[model samples]
Target: MTLRIRRRRFGQIAIATAATTALSGFAQRAFAQRGGPILYGVTLDSTGENLIIQALNLATGNILPINIQRRIEPGERISAFTAISGRFAIATGPRMALPGRRLGRRSRIISSTTEEIPEPQGLDNDAAFESLLNTNDNNLLSIISLNQGTPPFRFANVDRRSGRVNFLSDVDLLPNRRYSNLCQSPRGTTYGTSLGPDTGPVLVQFDFANRSIITGKARILPIAPLSYNKNLLVNDVADLALSPSNQLFALADPTYEGTNSLFIVNTQTGEMTFLRKFAVQKITFTR
Candidate 1:
């Protein structure tokens, strides 16, 4: 079967089986007893024309579609996604736009009232917001840019209530090391994935409050390379998320071949466990 067919079949089987179990009343009770936070993932529909948000039950592995007020267009790409103050904050840009061109790339907080985050000054017109996390204050959101000035990466906080941007310190100048995505736990500990030219992917813990890397140089992920028709290597992480209970999860993508998969990452031991085949681009846990 083709990749699209496999993905459609997977979605169908997951939803149908979950629905059946829910009707039987076992899955719902199990989920409630566990009291785990619902993990949300964003994926394309079967037609690949629109994005669909689904709520995933970690305990039962059941997926249910979620309805949002704002409809994401087909050509728009979600660069960053997260939840704060019981609402969804999404950073998106048009995929068809040319490089160095601004095509209305911005961040939006969706709730009873939709708010747009203003683009900060001194950044290139093409700079895109790549990561978002909630701060201690409900109205302030921590964000990072894909491209900034000299060092190329900047960390800042956005005030959702007043539409103000407060520039924080720039990311540390680590030679040959770059961060791809960022996520924070409910207790305010932030983590990121660091990539380098000579080393494999490492999970770097950060104390964003002080704008420093806590783990000087984290160990490489314990994921082995998959050998298929050719050797397929997992080289990059597309997204990272932390559950309410502080479990680190990653959407790992192969460098050249193979499909994206979700993994449960152990922060202390640098170990990873394959969770499921996730073809989605973004995943976040509901608050």
Candidate 2:
């Protein structure tokens, strides 16, 4: 909380200043009006040394910059983020903290303290949280853990106010499968991306209420090869966000050469249509 963006050299500062001035208009509009579905995510500064939160208007393709910028600490990186109600939560490794800003206002770090989620029994201490979702209940956040030598990933709910974590029962159906980019619909349906046995990347649904995988709905995604580099194929979905209207957007994993792409994913047919170039590290939908 309240982390500052590290200042850069004189030359870099000049460039950042110019960029900031250019973005001032978008910021004003973002704070001034209530609009359609907005996608929020973290992107690196022009210097690639600081992280800036941005809001994208799906209907108008306008990008707005949040006032706060934070520098990544040594060996630390943003792993998960979600925006729901009037608040947003960000996770850097095992720590989760709420930013100070409410919608339509300049952001501040609300609390000076960041909460660390305790690892469940039998889970490797090194396993960190990889995904976060806003559930129907505003008081609870759904979380998924990264598998580090573990067979099945861990699922749990974190109490937003008390910092309490309640682990769900094991999902035995998805043993040895690696899933990431977890997102949920307004109806409490959870979905994530995972690799298929032969077809490559696929979308899998989970029934959190029943603690079971919806195997019948899993479908292999028809991801296309990179336009610039035909040899490079997208191996994973870096992030996923679902709108209130049920539109699924996906961020394709950056290539080894560092090309980032975004797409509109058809959940029923597993077809992905190219949208545009994307630079965000994580994404979530907010109204």
lDDT per residue, candidate 1, 1-287, as tens digits?
A: 00010032233323323211222133234357555566766666666544555666766565665434345555456767776645556666445455786455443333312444444543445455566665444434444444431125555666665545666543353544555566767776667666666665666666434422554432223233222224333465778888878898888764333667677877765566777776677788754
Name the regions of candidate 2 deviating beyond 4 angstroms: 1-35, 46-49, 94-124, 146-151, 196-199, 209-234, 254-257
Clashing pairs in 2: 100-108, 100-110
Report residue 258 deviation for candidate 1 (angstroms).
5.6
Q: Return the top candidate by TM-score.
A: 1
Candidate 1 Cα RMSD (Å): 9.3
Poorly placed runs, candidate 1 (over 4 Å): 1-35, 46-49, 72-75, 94-123, 139-143, 146-151, 170-176, 209-234, 255-259
Provide the lowest-lDDT 10-residue window in model 2: 1-10
Model 2 earns a TM-score of 0.66
Write down the RMSD of all candidates, one decimal each: 9.3, 10.7
